[model samples]
Target chain A: MDGYKGFLGLLVSSLLVGFLSVIFTLIWVLHYREGLGWDGTALEFNWHPVLMVTGFVFIQGIAIIVYRLPWTWKCSKLLMKSIHAGLHTVAAILVIIALVSVFDFHNALSIPNMYSLHSWVGLTVVILYILQLLLGIFIFLLPWAPLSLRAFVMPMHVYSGLLIFGTVIAAVLMGVTEKLFFALSGYSKFPPEGVFTNTLGLLIVVYGALIFWIVTRPQWQRPKEPNSVLLQPNGGAQEGAGGLTVNFSNVDTPDSKLNHEASAKKRNFTADEVGQRSTM
Target chain B: MDGYKGFLGLLVSSLLVGFLSVIFTLIWVLHYREGLGWDGTALEFNWHPVLMVTGFVFIQGIAIIVYRLPWTWKCSKLLMKSIHAGLHTVAAILVIIALVSVFDFHNALSIPNMYSLHSWVGLTVVILYILQLLLGIFIFLLPWAPLSLRAFVMPMHVYSGLLIFGTVIAAVLMGVTEKLFFALSGYSKFPPEGVFTNTLGLLIVVYGALIFWIVTRPQWQRPKEPNSVLLQPNGGAQEGAGGLTVNFSNVDTPDSKLNHEASAKKRNFTADEVGQRSTM
Candidate 1:
């Protein structure tokens, strides 16, 4: 399969920026704010940013890009799906803890919870992330699921995953903005703390944009494995009615469903479409 | 010629939420804060949100999706491109004024400017937006340009347009959060103003998500015109090297270049490839 030019360079930049965001958040909380702890105090509140950057932004980004990694290309589809789901599960767990830390800090200080736009959007992302993970496991990882249903659900799955990732990035930015206003008194004066945190926010945005660019590129998408056993309705010979199970799930977004439409009819590729395929 | 199912419904919802976002920003500035002005008061700062919502979020979103509208399908591709660039031009002008308002407000108040993360991201978006606009005009809207160059630049043009739109929405949300914390007293108590502003933020997010969804759907993409004059290298038969200008820009993100590759080679579509085309 033809791979994207500069794929490695972009992927490396994405990870480099992603790790920088996590490290910056860690330093912001540890050195500028207070060190993290489990107590129901501001120290515990520090855990929120740390966990969020680690889980939601960094780990979740990795999960989204894992399928596109060239090293993973040779792995079984089922194995790749496990790594994807497992990373997401870890991210969800950390995000859940991060939420609890915020709520606990609010309760301890008698500050209200879920009052800010950041909270509203953050909660929505968390809920959607969880639902996406659950549905993904049930439909994609489960052995007994029908191929047609997977094909039907694949595009929505990819789209929603990207949406959730984007929403999370937006919410994190909102939270960063809100925090600077509340915590930094001389923030408007461009204090060192303010400048450093602003850089962190920029890094996060750049990292996210890079991830989106990498994921949405037609060339970088995970290629369809027509011979994968899991793509069959029941592993071996129990193909779906009308041989719909023969339509392999492309796993690429925006056009996956379209390809599904083509393959569901069991059509063979022509030279023109082969050129189109290379474009993808 | 098949159009997307429920395209109209989604388009309507996108506009509705987008307009609601603008309306909510208006109310927040007018009723909650002081009325708009140009005297470099906080009232003058009010134009920041108003112009941002009207131009960047609402109109900019419409510009991004204008091609996807069904009624506009009858319009020539050149005309549609004009409307697209024209709308973006309007958006850029308003955004410039909005930037002036903020800088003037800050200078008048003896407060520093471009200190906050919001400002950093907002300024980056504005700069990139202007660059995208200029390049778009030169590459896409102008006559006598080579069709090959247009095809080469179209994907980056669309990708950057969407990226700028998303970044603008994120910056706006960050600004909204910063404003709430700065202006509203006891905001954590969830005052009526805070709640209203929160709803506005959610509306903006929903509107952005809807626009992204509508724009990215393969079925809703602008159909390629195989015989359009504008697609010719120099119009009336001065075709480019290797007859490359025969490749029509699909005007669709993520896959347009793929279709271009398919067409540039001048291969006929077989039945299998035609099915794949429907997927696109």
Candidate 2:
């Protein structure tokens, strides 16, 4: 077996590297280019990359992988869910600010908005991110949805979460490269700052690959507790109850224990859920 | 159960879209920019993106998901292994050509190589891709290695395969965006070409998401035949008979039946494989 300490050590180091890489990108932008602000100027556009990468890339990554950290297991699943949702909420707010900065700066300069591929893809991902977050809260946290609907949405939510994380990284990479190429068009990239910015971009890619590795590897997935509520409380209430959770065994994230208990008790499902579970 | 027809239909459609996206990218470059060539000019650099996207992104994606196609289930393992390895080999060749074109064009024009983030990440991916391909063939296809060694490396091989696929897409996205921004400098993105290229990129992202969803989802993984040769031929010969295919459950791709029979008979290992399977 792999050493527990080794896994934890890697996790800590990667987390530090991931966070620091985001910070380093921001620092490079502030140090070499323009300092971050929302003063409705070209300098305001600098906050666009820094804040977006910080929130959409680094902070969101932490939120997604929070369950995998050992210290999180000590908390109740409800607390962890709150923490997950809370972190994502902060990320969402930061991204909104980032978007506003970009749009405002563009508008102030009479520049066209939503024109570049980076802008197009970046805007689409931000929309998807907001939708994913909203749907996550609606289905997972709020009591507006029933239990079986939550089960059906959970896998898609997880997939979208990871997909969005990846797309955000792509946007970051694309956006940064766009800025560099546009700004440094006269030169052939022999400048030291060009190399420095390229290094920053590489760090972003490394951070992204690291996050994907930590989150997606099967062995590194959060292990199921064997007696999670789905198996126990729903056994008598629903037919073929375990089918809905076959994918859960793979993801095995400890979400919300309160929701799990409340949702597990209502195991009855309509034809739609049956169809969903069949495809599960 | 999910309809076999429905799953097959989605797979076929997505594959077509994925393939066409690669073609669309190629056509866009050929039509709008310089047509494909290797005369050590700026036009030669055009071939880099088209060839890389078609081969590394599209064809490599096909290779990764080939086993998931139900028609491959009847093949006796070894044929599929050959097909998988052969496809990857072709992809490696294409990527090499793409890289050479870039480097060659850069050299002729007195431009620097590996200066951009896309080139840095792209070159690293190519190196890793070649290494992954070699290691895979060595542990999996070549007769030099024992089955226990293959089993030990299976999980990492699978993870690396998926990781490389994701990275290739990231590199493609980065490379494409860099080209667009650099080329479109001094002009705002208010043109038909920009729209067309953006659509091309969005297609790549969609195609990638579909491939990942198909290959990584649990229910959609290629199912292993329960009575594959690893269990039968090595029953009496090896101490731990199933040591050869412990992680075969994960990568249930059909490979060479001959190797399965021949190598399955000898499961010799010096204790490392013993510890490996415990985690497996």
How high is the CA lDDT of each candidate model? 0.71, 0.65
Task: Please list all clashing residue pairs in model 1, or write none if there are none.
Answer: A258-B279
Count the clashes in each prediction: 1, 5
**Model 2 chain A: worst 10 consecutive residues (lDDT sum):** A237-246
User: How would you encode candidate 1's per-residue C-alpha lDDT over A72-188 as one tens digit per residue?
Assistant: 767766687789999999999999999999999999988889989999999999999999999988877766544455544664676688778888988999999999999899897
TM-score of each candidate? 0.84, 0.83
Model 2 chain B poorest 10 in a row by lDDT: B237-246
RMSD of 1: 8.1
* RMSD after CA superposition, every candidate: 8.1, 7.1
**Worst ten in a row by lDDT for model 1 chain A:** A238-247
lDDT of 2 by residue, B1-280 (tens): 2346756776887788888887788777788777877799868998888888789988998888776676676775667778889999999999999989999999998887877878878888899999999998876766555444555566567657776887788788888787877675534757777777778888888888887666544344344455422322112111111101112222222335535533444354221122121110
